[model samples]
Target: MPPQPSLSFTLPSIHDNTKLDCRIYQPYHSNPSNPSIPPYSSSSDPSWPRHAAVVAHPYAPLGGSYDDPVVHLVASTLLDLGFVVATFNFRGASSSSGRTSWTSKPERADYMSVTGFLVYYMHYLTAPQNHARSIEEDNNSPPILLFAGYSYGAMVTLQLPPIDSFLSHFASPATHTAFADIRLRAQHLAEEQSTMSADPASPRKSLGMRFGGDEDLSPRSRGKHRAHSPDPEEKIRRGVKDILSRSKFIHRRHHSPSADRGTERNIEVPCLENVDNLIRFRPAYLLVSPPLGFVTNLATMSFSNLWPKKRKDGRTKNLEDYTKREESEVETEAKLTANPTLVIYGDHDSFLSIRKMRDWATKLSNVEGSRFRYVEVLTAGHFWIEHGVSQELREAVYSFSAGLVKS
Candidate 1:
């Protein structure tokens, strides 16, 4: 089948105020009268797909982009399942602004900005103000948002800021100045990290493994590796400590403006109830071959560890501060446990070994609710380049999404 037509646009990253290239892949709708040509709609059409998705590409340094094969595969799968998919280039990748950071902290702004744009777009389309003919004629409801990321992108997605908090902050006037401050802090981090040789500039060098279709591992091998793997709890604890230490610097720079300035600004900004209405759409997250070690380490870390501290007196806090506080009150795993989430990886995955994948499954399985599940495709590598593996991944994701409706 031919690829669906995608609308291209640029979104300013909240981190550095840099313009990031983005594309929205609208689901295919048949043109009955003119079968030879593809159907097109400039506004919301009832016949068009309802749910929307924002998919993050894999690691940028390793040739990952909005155009990556896996990204397209997932986007296409979601589109086939009746969704409008949005994909974008992360910082330092393609034409996006600023260099990539070692951790997922900086990408928080990028993810939140893209999410905010979609939420606001949906709100506008559904609002009575939009005069688009198709929308007025059809009166279709808005799309539900889904956030899916692969590999390094998954790491960033796992650490995404709280949605309500992000929306509140985005709706505030201090957003620009806050973003400017984040940009400066990011620039400083980029300068500091540039001197270090720790960052991996590329994916694994097993060219034959990645492309030759000969590196697939067996389920037995995966089981043996899992049996021999070290206890995940200690490693998780150590990782959390290290991540907290590293994230301290990032949090210190996220300070909000004074209470008086914020109060004065809040009067001009939309009310809390209004902001909530604007962002009524919530998102379900899917992680494909996420590096378990990285995800688990940061997933449980509190927002207080990465967000600026507020004074004891409630007056010192603003919407952003309160949002951060609200997020800090809950554990990341607890939040995901409350929502629909899926984690998929391969027995022979390059990014996350089978043993680590098992570890994540075990850890997340302990969550109170059965809101999380995982699928392991046998003989498939991290990238799912082998024949039929991508399809299996798609089916897994689709099934998970379908299950979401049932729950």
Candidate 2:
């Protein structure tokens, strides 16, 4: 089958103000008239098929982006299985702004921003129109969010905080904040999409036309604005309003050349709501060729022993801080274990030895009540470029996703 159509847009990183290029692909069978493809759920049906997936590419410094073939393969598989798949560039990748960081914290925040946006977008699109009725009443089943990554991206995915903790950051963001801005953007786009789904022949505006202006601004110009612009909050609000106004004009001016002009539908900027009740997702995980050992540590600059020695008076404070960090890590690990997790690697992998990978996988799978699982292809390598390994990878992903749908 041919590739499915996708919506191209940019999302701001909560870490910095840099924009990350992103795309969201709806399933091929979303159209009502496409009888060749088996229908999973009606596009207009606001209740079922609330499954969404985010696929992350490999290392950014090594030329990985949303267009990576491995990323494409996984995303395509999920899309075929009725998932609204999302793929995005990390900072320093492709047209996204900013340089990659050594500590990896900023990258983790970037991932969080995208995930949060997807969660809100899904909620808005699937939510019932009746505000009085509970959203859960329309759909008895909760939404499923699959977080999948490859190579360095997989490592970053594993280190992410639990779903609840991550969603808490966006629960009730203050007005004029970056989190608030993200929620606004997601709602606007979701409204546009819902409209299009109702009338498939509508003339759609590109995200660039809708959210223009800043894309042409140089990084130096942005830096200057940050340095000199007082009232940055007001500036952000004005920018959003200006973009919407420009989009309205563009839509009217380019309405039609051969047919009678009609009144354009007013674009409603959705009001922000307390999203805590709207977001209730069951999380699943998929890791493809996740790196391990010393190389991973060096790339992330994670040296535990590099901390400065504490004074005798501060020893207790230092110990308390360490304990808190350890507990946070343990909490994240426990969440991963409780979810449906799958790690796929190759025995002939180049970056990490088979022995170390086997040991890590075995240890995780052996945890009490753990749902973690793994698949190690005998002759495949890190890239899965071997003759038949790509097929194996696809099959494994298909089976995992099929299980999610059935359950």
Best by lDDT: 2
- lDDT for each residue of candidate 2 in 1-407, tens digit (9 for 90 to 100): 21533456778888876778877776755542253433222236644477899888899999988878899899888877778888889999988889888878888888889899898878777554435235444665565799999998898898888878877767766434567667767766676566666654445412111232233348998777557755433544565565445442211122223344654544424323475347477899999998877667666664553575576776654466567757865875686789999999988898886788898789889999999999988788988899999999999999988898778
Measured on C-alpha atoms, candidate 2 has an lDDT of 0.73
lDDT of each: 0.59, 0.73
Please identify model 1 stretches exceeding 4 Å from their true place: 1-5, 30-44, 47-49, 129-143, 174-279, 294-330, 405-407
Candidate 1 residue 359 C-alpha distance from true site, Å:
2.5
lDDT of 1 by residue, 9-34 (tens): 45567776765666655454543223
Q: Which candidate is the best by TM-score?
A: 2
Weakest ten-residue segment in model 1 by summed lDDT: 205-214
lDDT score at residue 315, model 1, on the 0-100 scale: 44
Residue pairs with backbone overlap in model 2: none
**True-vs-predicted CA distance for residue 390, candidate 1, Å:** 1.3
What are the clashing pairs of model 1?
none
